[model samples]
Target: DAQAAICMVRGHAAEWNISADKIGFLGFSAGGGVAIASTMSATQMERPNFLCTNFGPSLMPVTVPADAPPLLIMTSADHPNVAAGLVALFMEWKKAGANAEMHIYGDGTGPYELMPETGETTTESWSRQMLQWLKSKRFI
Candidate 1:
């Protein structure tokens, strides 16, 4: 379904007034695992230009492709399983020489929210940080 979506969007890029090369995938929590899976065995036409996984780690073993898209992983340090999984995914990307960046926020232990809550910490700034990363990578 993810590959189908990518193909659909890319195929209609000009009609949609979007650049095919700028297409990316972003998933949160379990959806992140889906995003990762989408890339693992994708053909060139089905691959996203980049991937962002927010507090969502692959549920299964990962095999990073040599031509894997740049990756951005965001999670909270206190969320042991998520943090560890994201770190492992980042390491796999690095081992494959794929561009990857990660942010393990120190203050929280669960999925970060987009809206700021009372006494919010840097975890809420993930969206901004992600935008900066995208810009830096020229993906936007």
Candidate 2:
């Protein structure tokens, strides 16, 4: 899924007059995990035996720029696994000198779900906050 997404994003860069080297990925929940895994795993030289043989096409080289855009993640503190995974991913990005930030909200009113109503406060305009972060990073 990550490879496909990256490929598709890269494939469209030319039409937008944007360089693929400048593209960055943002994902939520399960998609977040996949994005982290994909960015790292795409650099491997050997194919894993666990993957199906029928998988088509190797991706473009994983060239995480020295100035790669920031990664922002929001997870629930009540969900330890989600928090842990995000922290670990953050550590990896930090070690690679890639910018990343994560927020784990305590006492979230919802679990693993995004609220649609105006009264929702768990995620509390997380999408808006993400947009702000992206704007701060010059990604938008």
Q: Report the poorest 10 consecutive residues by lDDT, candidate 2.
A: 47-56
Candidate 1 per-residue lDDT over residues 17-136, each given as its tens digit: 999999999998899999999988888889999999988774457999888999999888777888788888999999999999998876544654433454544555787799999999
TM-score of each: 0.89, 0.63
lDDT of 1 at 5: 96
- lDDT per residue as tens, model 2, 15-35: 878766556665555555455
Residue pairs in collision within model 2: none
lDDT of 2: 0.53
Pairs in steric clash, model 1: none
Question: What stretches of model 2 exceed 4 Å from their correct place?
Answer: 16-22, 43-69, 111-120
Stretches of candidate 1 exceeding 4 Å from the true structure: 107-109, 112-123
